[model samples]
Target: MPEGTPELSAKDLRTLIPEYEGLALATTLLNPEPGEPGVRESSLGGPLLWPADEPWPYCAQEDHWTFGSDLRNTTEIVAGTVPTVPILQLFARDVPGLEFPEGKDLLQVVWCALNHEHDPGPVMPLLYWRNEAEVVAGGLLSEIPVAGEGEYDEDHMPEPSTLSPTPTDDYPSRHDLPEDVRDTWEPRFRSPTSGGVMWPSDSNVIATKAGGWPAWIQPADWPDCDGGHRMEHLLTITGDIQLGDCGGVYFFHCRRCPGLPWDWRFDCH
Candidate 1:
């Protein structure tokens, strides 16, 4: 490193994350009750058994639902489904002038939001702008924005750090079903109806709940934000990993998923 040697711009960092075709992700909002348990409601002068295991009411909006009772006592359950583009809509509408930059990609934005990195120093640029010119290095790439580069430099090339070939099961795997998956959900705020979770609950804590069955389920081919989603079970995919880097993501699922016994694939994308 030298005094005038330019540093990697935010645009440069953005190039690291290669978005595969399926590199997309969404937030699961509700885990509505599936199959017949004890809830048998047929409503309006009829029975009350949930007419063939329908999803919970407002389950589609589970992302913003306020909790009332426990799963056993309540008649329905819900979570959120945060599709990327729609999720962006939510962020844009809430932000003043939608003036947020350096955090755009859903997973990265969600991670920053979750980790409380409101004042992004390094990651802001990478995730915020896809195009290089719009980045913080906008016009200052070689103008020297920092002075610490020379401080860490050495007279000659330093030897590469080495690790022992001996391996251990220190973090052999990443399997844990996390409950503390925190999220920021507002009250009854309405907008252009972005696709997410909404239900009646005390907190807008965003995370996944038991999907009823241990296997998998998909409610309908074309799911709407309604009763249809609740009936669907938790569709899962698993694998293993060292780190999950997106626009800038840090899914704690590595610790939260193992406990639940997911296949845990090494490569999610």
Candidate 2:
């Protein structure tokens, strides 16, 4: 368990509700605090260790725009492409338990810092698994494109922060519990110390974490990969960044297939 975090034992959970047995999953809580981080370090909204030769990703979606109206008529908006900004950079050394593709030790996530109408997430979020040594050997991209002031949505652009990853056991949220378990447990095993709050409410951690079930605000919508295999939750972006209406962005990947296909979803308060 992470220090200073509330204790929630799986054994106690199972004793109260047997159906919860073996439901605990390994997860890493990425506690982010605002700071400047080096390119090689694990961080949120930090500079990426990107290869110099690789073309940077840009969102071509013409519908994206900031919440403010003044900058909406700019030439860049008229051109219809916006540069994607780094949202997260995770190193294997910080999250050793996280599964990585063969020879890959880093995970970098980028998304257009603009809002897309009628979409669940950022205009186009991109994930990359890379070898740290290979990126270093090939030379790093010294110049990265930054979204000009007023061109980016401040809500989606997280301030650069360093990460302190803490590995712990995570359990499903109340929403993810089976109907039978909810029915049987809620009535018979209410916690005396919790006031009126239920056990699951105290147990689940809702923050930027890797692995485990999503901190879903609504019903869970676990997506399947192209190969039909259920994807596993890879990351959750919340608590540290303010998405639309204080929502969370979730990332998932399928390990059963090659290339590790991934997807994302957004949920708000």
Candidate 3:
């Protein structure tokens, strides 16, 4: 509904699976210049409004998918900017009609320092914050200080020369789409090439219908809910959120359970 090609119409999809429910699709392409407005309520390619009291998040796990000498480079890039790494926050509350667990609000945070690295190493760094207030106060209401110069760790600072070249092709179109794909969708739907919804129309299967980019629906990676049922596909933050070639950030949640804490995962292809 946010303006993109849908893989299947609700009527057509229901014909295939009568029990199919709908999904809300949102897509955003970020601008990477310094000093620009980086934070927005439900968009990607923006800065995160992190509390000044919180330390900048670092990949502490030694076995992280993208760990090694490149870690330093990634760290440096994140810290290179005057105001820490750009963070994108997706809140379930802001997503109209999203049926999240009761008494809890879900927020998925993603940050990647190296958007253009040939190999972004491992999965991009991610954080999940679950606010348990009935009214969902604080972070949403309070005016907090954002991370700025001298706030981040100095040791991880990057040298001016090592930063990845500024991304010139902010949003590249998919020229390699197969004839079948090209024929099935319109030009506007096929181009822009990245970020869109892959709604779940077949039981637990998520079908890619919007942008040519596909959403990865990995049940094994889905976080379990207290209701004893697997989480459902909420939506995906697709496009170049700096995770490397055509990476997508997927979000899942349990409709029956309340505040199971962690419910999101990231993957790229």
Candidate 4:
């Protein structure tokens, strides 16, 4: 390795990682605020910049996930031996969808920041948090309790004395913001927009294609409310991933996958 070597581009990652061929190029049309600068549409998110010392609990019997390199590196980094950089914002709100509303992603994030911690899929906001980057900036998203009643006190902080367990007669639906709390959560995550090629890669995602035909997965065991179909999730690719024979756990980070571009010269000179 050279001293001035640059970081690996998403294209380069495809080659370094095996089993890359099993991926489908699913595009997430991010509904960031209009005219927002630096937010690139059709952009691919990948190569999750994890911490050397992961704050997550022990999964199975294995040690926690190492942020950057090896244990020595993670320790050095944590003990102020290695430099610490501000964690970047790598996660999007929703699991990429067609016309997926703006505040929806934030709603999911807020929900994660507020209530649900681990595997928040089937329970809260109907979303998943596997590869989504923990919102590190606002300290909103932290390692959710791997077990039990969660650990954060922000969302759980007791409200005003009057805000008790007793519920009012009713509440509002569509929120108009400063207008009223009732209408606030009304229009957020409306039933996922149906019709058209919404989720081409989702196993449970059901949508009518260009030919007025439904497409998605259907099985007897699939869970549902009204017996509807369910789409599968984009999975993380984990195996004996080795970076120069020193194995590094590999996860499927979607960088628009250029069909698993084999190793490139990199030097654009």
Per-residue lDDT of 256 in model 1: 27
Candidate 4's error at 219, in angstroms?
Answer: 16
Cα lDDT tens digits for candidate 1, 120-167: 211111111122223323332232111122111111111111111111
TM-score comparison, 1 vs 4, better candidate:
4
TM-score of every candidate: 0.14, 0.87, 0.43, 0.19
Ranking by TM-score: 2, 3, 4, 1
CA lDDT of every candidate: 0.19, 0.81, 0.38, 0.21
lDDT of 2: 0.81
Model 2 agreement with the true structure over 91-124: per-residue lDDT tens digits: 9999987988899999999998877666745658
lDDT of 3: 0.38
lDDT per residue as tens, model 3, 1-269: 24563555445534543322222223222222333442334334344545434555553333222223555643333323323343444445444344445444544454433332343322344655554343233343244334444333322222111111111111112222234543553432332434453332322213211111225533235567766786755544443233344345555656565554335555545
Query: How would you encode candidate 4's per-residue C-alpha lDDT over 138-246 as one tens digit per residue?
Result: 2332333322222221222211111001111111111101233224322431224431211112221121111111221221121222223332222211111111211
Reference-based lDDT, residue 181, model 2? 75
Best by lDDT: 2
Residue 42 shift from truth in candidate 1, angstroms: 57
Off by over 4 Å in 3: 1-40, 63-84, 91-94, 99-108, 112-124, 130-214, 217-228, 240-242, 245-247, 255-259, 263-268
Give the total clashing residue pairs for model 2: 0
> How far does residue 101 in candidate 4 sit from its true spot (Å)?
9.5
